[model samples]
Target: MLRFFRWYCKPDLIEDIEGDLLANFHRTLRQEGPAKAKRKLAIQIILLFRPGIIRIFNLSGFQDHFKLIQHFVISWRRIKSNLTFSLINIGGLGVGMAIAMLIGLWVWDELSFNKSFTNYTELAQLYQNRTFDGQTGTYKIVPQPMSRD
Candidate 1:
């Protein structure tokens, strides 16, 4: 722990000073109650000259604020990628649904017509009738009689 502190506060006698403070703190805590011990610890911490706790704000001049731009760029890239992927997914689903609907409509029309026709099983088209002359004659023919079947 001492080596770690020494390395962390390079070129400074922070480790020695902290060790002395800790030793004095433990001695004081042994003589005082827990409440006074906590108060004394807080006072010591506030009085410690640790450079890590200091904040450097540029009040007199403009600050080099590039982090906000970097953050925005990253956020925009993520949004664009997500939007593109969603558009592709929605487009594929829409086209598939349209094709399915078209096929369904065609099948429904064919089946409805078949069902609406009267005597659908007996329906037939008449072919041309042969004649004695070389020319052929035609006539639309129906069933000879319903009883003939």
Candidate 2:
């Protein structure tokens, strides 16, 4: 509970607030016992999450606010400077990405072939040779087995 409070509390106020919380927790633990003390601790932590107590909201992309705008401005200027070159480069990137996606999907399909069957591990390709018009040719599957001693 204290760790949670520390995560969002302002740096300078964390030590002071944490000391106060620990002191209060000890008091409550002695008066009312552990369960009640825990509940009080959680309630106090929740109450302390207000605007003045909690640290700044630094969510994803928050730190990059100015950098993102600057990058957009620079990219816009570059694109506007050479419209034809920018369009060609963007088209090439699109085609390359599409080809990469297609190749990845194809490789996935080839690797997954025959894996859907329950007896795939026991399956094997059998080949045999036979004569047709005095010409012998080899082909898959054994229709019959011949044995001799």
Judging by TM-score against the true structure, name the best candidate: 2
Please provide, for model 1 over 1-149, each residue's C-alpha lDDT reduced to its tens digit, 9 standing for 90 to 100: 33444444535556566777678777888998667766776676566536773334345433335666778899778768899886787799999999999999998876665455766666555566867668877766665765444
Clashes of each: 0, 0
Q: On residues 1-149, what C-alpha lDDT tens digit does candidate 2 reach at each position?
A: 88899898999999999999999999999999999999999999999998998888667686589789999999999999999999999999999999999999999986676787876665445778999999999997755434331
Q: Show the lowest summed lDDT stretch of 10 residues, model 1.
A: 55-64
Instruction: Report, for every candidate in turn, its global Cα lDDT versus the true structure.
Output: 0.67, 0.89
TM-score, predicted candidate 2 vs. hidden true structure? 0.44
Q: Which stretches in model 1 have alpha-carbon errors above 4 Å?
A: 1-11, 49-149
TM-scores vs. true structure, each candidate: 0.29, 0.44
After superposition of all CA atoms, the RMSD between model 1 and the true structure is: 17.7
